[model samples]
Target: MDFVLVHGTTQSPAGWDRVAKLLTAAGHRAIAVDLLTPRDLPVEGYAQHARDQYDGERPVVVAHSGSGVLLPAIAEALDARALVWVAAYIPDFAGGRSLRDEASAVLEPDWIGVDPTADPAKASEFLFHDCDPETERPALDSLRLFNPAVLAAHPAGAAPEVPSTVIVPTRDRTLRPDWLRRAGRERLGVTPIEIDAGHCPHLSRPAELAAILTGRA
Candidate 1:
């Protein structure tokens, strides 16, 4: 099966490197996208970029962190087979809360004007506290500045019409596990697949993460 991996805000395709490598080694195709930047683009624009990356194949669309809101649009555009949320923000459409609003309530206080790339120490603490030095260092070094505009944008109208799964990192400090569980249940209506790792499980536990992705776990 094909897997189109979408990284969160400010993150590059490199974030999926380890997981993608493992997926390929196991005989599945993995396509990781570097989300469009400047964050000024509408949600549709982000979805279009994701759609454009497709090679005319209906892949399982896997989104991480803030990119969850875009899954509905991208899935519609690509006719994706399934959707996977990895420690992602599941927008509450029925509750009338946009993904940005939900995320801002949790993340904006600390991240608003801070440049992730400029403050490796802070970034490391927020994103990689559970990661070992070897795993955390490179991630910190590659951190990019998050686009404020993206955080300000709202989600698309409807929920994605595809099979979906939510993967919650049990030890995640960035997006607390309890919050993710409530959000996943209320928004996506699915029981989360819990992983004993941090926010970036693809980096911290690639083999385990890959097993879940491939339906072997």
Candidate 2:
């Protein structure tokens, strides 16, 4: 199967490198897209950008972190086979809330706002705590300051009718694991698959993530 890997905020397509390589080695096509900048573009535009990255068959669209808000739109645009959320925020289509609003309501006030690109030390500690320095270095370097408007933008339309899987990084320090579990059950309507990894599982647990992506886990 083919896979479209979308990275989270403050991240780049390079974050998906290891997982993509593993999937490609297993005879699956995986394209990690750079979710375009000028972040104020309509959510549909972001979806279209991701779709244009792969010309292969319909894929399993996987979203990480902030990219989750755009997942439903992206899945619909690509006519994806499935939707996968890895340590990602699951949006409520009916709520008419922005990612920031939703996150603030459930998360501790202090956790709600922080620029990931502002502090490399803090970013590494929260996002890559389970990762080694080699993995942490590039991820930190790749952090880009996305517009705050992106978080304030709401996801458009209802979630597409498709099979969806949410993978919770059990040891995640960034997005609280307990909050993720509640969000997965309440919004996505499914129990999440748990992985013993931190926020960036693609970097921290590539082989295991690849296994889950390939349906081997």
By lDDT, the best candidate is 2
lDDT of 2 by residue, 192-217 (tens): 88999988899999999999989822
Error of 2 at 160 (Å): 2.5
| Superposed Cα deviation of residue 31, candidate 2 (Å) | 0.4
Candidate with best TM-score: 2
User: Candidate 1's residue-wise lDDT over 25-133, tens digit each?
Assistant: 9999999976765556777787788777778678888888777777777777778889998988787767667755666554535555555566777777667777887
CA lDDT for candidate 2: 0.81
Candidates in order have lDDT scores of 0.77, 0.81
Off by over 4 Å in 1: 37-39, 104-114
Cα lDDT, model 2, residue 26: 94
